[model samples]
Target: MRYCLGLDMPGDAALIAEYENWHTDIWPEVRKSILDSGIVNMEIYRLENRLFMIMEVGPDFSFDRKAAMDAANPAVQRWEELMWKYQVAIPGGKPGEKWRLMDRIFSLQEAL
Candidate 1:
């Protein structure tokens, strides 16, 4: 299923620049973890400090499964830790939630 979510980066100007650099090509290990967790497609967009992401997850998507896989892979865990250094949860957002899912409001594809 396709999922839409949003997150935010640190608002500091310098930090935002650095975050942009890192996203130029995310860590390869991180990509492996996501793919191993059943994320078939992913993309991220930004507007100033706000970030939006779209991911196509498999039917078996499960947070616990992903978490467990991440925990088992130290390289992936380390990558996540490093990435988190630059990212901050969206203001007034849930503590552990990085990307908040968006509800589907309109979709022409839905009718197809």
Candidate 2:
């Protein structure tokens, strides 16, 4: 399955640069945790302070399960804490939520 999400980053140029730098070399532990949680592929894109993420996952993937795994992993928690320094909840997001799920409004597949 594929999932799409959105996040907001600080508009500061320096902070945005630092955020991109971190993604250039994500920690091994974080990557492992994602794969182990059933994610097959993930990509993040940025347009100014708005960030979009696309994730393709295995059949066993569950957002709730992934959240639980991340909460229990020290490295994942650390990474999230560091990332939160430059992230903010977008409008209408739930309290304490960083990434918000995006709704798919149109798909070309349906036209075929």
Candidate 3:
């Protein structure tokens, strides 16, 4: 399955740079956690302060399972805490929610 989500970064250019730098060499544990959670592929894009993520997951993936796994992994928790410094929940998102799932309004395959 594929999921697309949106988030926001602080408007500070320095902070955005730092966030990108961190992704350049993400910690092994953090990478492992993502793989173990059944995310087969992931990509993140930025447009000014707006951020978008595309994730392709295997059949074994579930948000609840991933959340439980992340909660149990101290390294993942630490990484999330560090990332929160640069990330902000999109408007209407719950407090502390970093990514908001986006609704797909149009798809070429569906349009056909």
Candidate 4:
């Protein structure tokens, strides 16, 4: 029910500043869209343009459909286009896959 993704920063300082400003308070509707999508917890962290997001959803969470719906929504699409100006994937990244899934090496919970 939890997922993580990372995004790199843009090379330009001015653009990076702009991006930070936007994130300081993202669009309200965007926030609503996410909350309505069955997400239980979500947060984003940044270390000099290297951004990481952690999201926890219900057992029925479906990123595939949610992603496609987001792509079709004009506001969301616009936001994504603008965001792309500040992010990119590393070499060997799969096509259409931006944030790579990280393996969980350790956890506090014990397997039943």
Candidate 5:
């Protein structure tokens, strides 16, 4: 399965630079946690202060399971805390939500 999500930065150049730097070398444990949660591939892209993430997951993946695993992992917790410094919840997001799942309104393949 594939999912797309959105997030935002504060539009500060310095903060954006720092956030990009952190992704250049994600902590070992955080990477491990991601793989363990059944995420087969992931990529993040940025356009100014807006950010998008694409995630491909295996059949066993579930958001509830991943959330529980992340909650139990100290490294994931720490990483999330650090990321929150640079991330802002999207306008319609629930309180404390960092990434908002995006709704796909169109697919070229489906149209074809």
Candidate 6:
């Protein structure tokens, strides 16, 4: 399955640069955690302060499962805490949420 999500970074150029630098060499533990959670592929894009993410997951993937796993892993928890320094919940996102799921309004495959 594929999932699209959005987030926002602080509107500081330095902070945004730091965030991008971090992604350039994500920690091995963080990458391992994602793979173990059944995420086959992931990509992130940014437009000013707005960030977009696309994830492709294996059949066994579940957001609940991933959350539980992340909660139990100290490294994952640490990574999230560091990331939160530059991230904020998108407008209308639930409290404590960073990434907001995007709704697909149109798909060429569906139209065809």
Candidate 1, residues 40-67, lDDT tens digits: the string is 9999898888888999999888878987
Give the per-residue Cα lDDT of candidate 6 at 64.
97
Question: What are the TM-scores, per candidate, against the unseen true structure?
Answer: 0.82, 0.97, 0.97, 0.83, 0.98, 0.97
lDDT score, candidate 1, position 47: 88
Clashes found in each candidate (C-alpha, N, C closer than 3 A): 0, 0, 0, 0, 0, 0
Off by over 4 Å in 3: none
Colliding residue pairs in candidate 6: none
Model 6 has a clash total of 0
Stretches of model 1 off by over 4 angstroms after superposition: none
**Candidate 2 error regions (>4 Å):** none
- Greater lDDT among 1 and 3 belongs to 3
Per-residue CA lDDT of model 3 for 4-109, tens digit only, reads 9999999999999999999999999999999999999999999999999999999999989999999999999999999999998888987778899898888999
lDDT for each candidate structure: 0.83, 0.96, 0.95, 0.77, 0.96, 0.96
Mind giving the per-residue lDDT tens digits that candidate 4 earns over 1-112? 8888777777778888888889899888677667767778888887876878899998767888678678777887788777777777755677756666666767768653
Residue clash pairs of candidate 1: none
Error of 3 at 97 (Å): 1.0
Candidate 2: residue 9 Cα off by (Å)? 0.7
* CA error at residue 77 for candidate 1, angstroms: 1.8
Better of 2 and 3 by TM-score: 2
Which is superior by lDDT, 1 or 5? 5
lDDT over C-alpha atoms for residue 42 of model 3: 94
Instruction: Report the Cα RMSD per candidate.
Output: 2.1, 0.7, 0.7, 2.3, 0.6, 0.7
